[model samples]
Target: MQGVTVVDHPLVQHKLTIMRSKDTSTASFRRLLREISLLLCYEVTRNLELTSKVIQTPMQEMEAPTLEGKKLVFASVLRAGNGLLDGMLDLVPAARVAHVGLYRDHDTLEAVEYFFKAPSDLENRLVIVVDPMLATANSAVAAVEKLKSRGATNLRFVCLLAAPEGVERFTKAHPDVPVFTASIDERLNEQGYIVPGLGDAGDRMYGTK
Candidate 1:
């Protein structure tokens, strides 16, 4: 857990419990994800560099702290990542967006990318990659690698749940990038699913499979 930070906020834990329930409806699950993501977003960006800017207040002129440098980029790992993306955008309305489309090849549980689109100025921005689950870390690793290839030096990975195996692999693969998650589950099942997890996140979020 060297480079990982678990949000563990009361609101985040409460909503995650509801999301983990099998009986939760798709609409409810999606809603909870968006809500929890806002809290996670708060924690993830907590250390963002701040610079004071002079602004005029009704009473008088004052210097207010504002985010420094270019706007941050939220690079969503398509589909499930969008669940977190929606709420993150609500919190950081000025942030830019990026999408990296990848899917697991069932046979190998490896990521296969089909599409990618990101801002032209990646090196100048901080990119946070969002994906709901890090069961195998295959997709997460691939997505981060793709972004690094495109000049994203300052990057982070955010997910709802992560398995110990996935976390170890991810950290070793990209130790420079920090990870944020709601929980690190017990372990991953044989089929590459997080044991006792909320089930397939994308499936539960979209009512598929």
Candidate 2:
């Protein structure tokens, strides 16, 4: 994919396999998600701009590399996104947070936004949108569109799994924003679910239907 990067790290793939199993319990699934997100977070922020800053270490004063410009913003797409959000925050505690609430309309497989909140200084920061699955790309696209409307120019999308259909639609819709995922599954089922994907991420995480 042109604008997509599939994180094929060994640990990421290993954890994803466990998460994809139907027998995995909610507690275990959530735990593995948080753990994997930490690894994914490492890859997503790999290219962040770095600037040297003077700092006093235990040994002596030295210039150390630190993230440049404004702090990062992780814009989570509602409930499922929070699974990725928790671990991302664990890695970047000082990073700001944003929430874009959206749900899939089963019949149309379209996103319907119910709530949205974010920092006012969106244009100054790099926003990384997080969601566990990019099945239809409806929610991911809508969330990014909403953020851009609020002045977020630099943005990236991160998910645990993505469908080829979803990736194509998402990239075509917002070619400027890059995508990071653990895997691009075979295809999306008729109900807009990623085939052979870990079933409904939100449901599995929360033990809901």
Candidate 3:
């Protein structure tokens, strides 16, 4: 609640509604995800500091504003997170990218990491961790933990949808990381899925089971 932001722009809401429909095709769902991710990126990076730079225009040289500090690092939490990553890259082409591959143990519902690779200078950059659904907060929390351990300090979490339980758990686990999402659903189902969610984001987006 305190550190969460819902991107309620009309375009974001409209695309989310389209994504939620069970009838939407896999291709359509992926397209909408990319589109909405751009909007989400806008909100997540809203407060990035800017510095003035003197540059030459077609007609004259003048001072212009540009992002301050090192290029941001966008850390994607495996397959599903890549859906959001593709779109975020569209908005911030210069930003660095990281991948954290984690999967939930079926029985235990705990996150397990298989792969992790990020920029060496994470200490000097802002890191934005992304996953489509923050259902249990297991993967999201684990991913952020890994990033922090690797020297990432300034961090944010962005997702397409979040459950109240996941948000509470995530915020409690990482109080310093702000969260950005399109919607916060009511609750998680017994299977750790968000009700009224867009189904399994990975499945719908990639035609997986």
Model 2 quality (TM-score): 0.99
Instruction: Write the residue-wise lDDT of candidate 3 on 79-146 in tens digits.
Output: 89999999999999999999999998878889999999999989999999999999999999999999
- Against the hidden reference, what TM-scores do the models get? 0.99, 0.99, 0.98
Where does the lowest 10-residue lDDT sum fall in candidate 1?
195-204
Task: Give lDDT tens digits, candidate 1, residues 1-209.
Answer: 89999989999999999999999999999999999999999999999999999999999999999999999999999889999999999999999999999999999999999989999889999999999999999999999999999999999999999999999999999999999999999999999999889999999999999
Q: How does candidate 2 score on lDDT?
A: 0.97
Looking at candidate 3, the ten consecutive residues that score lowest on lDDT are: 103-112
lDDT of candidate 2 at residue 167, scale 0 to 100: 98
Instruction: Tell me the number of clashing residue pairs for each predicted model.
Output: 0, 0, 0
Q: Give the TM-score of candidate 1.
A: 0.99
Query: Model 2: runs farther than 4 Å from truth?
Result: none
Candidate 3, RMSD to the unseen true structure: 0.7
lDDT of 1: 0.96
Clashing pairs in 1: none
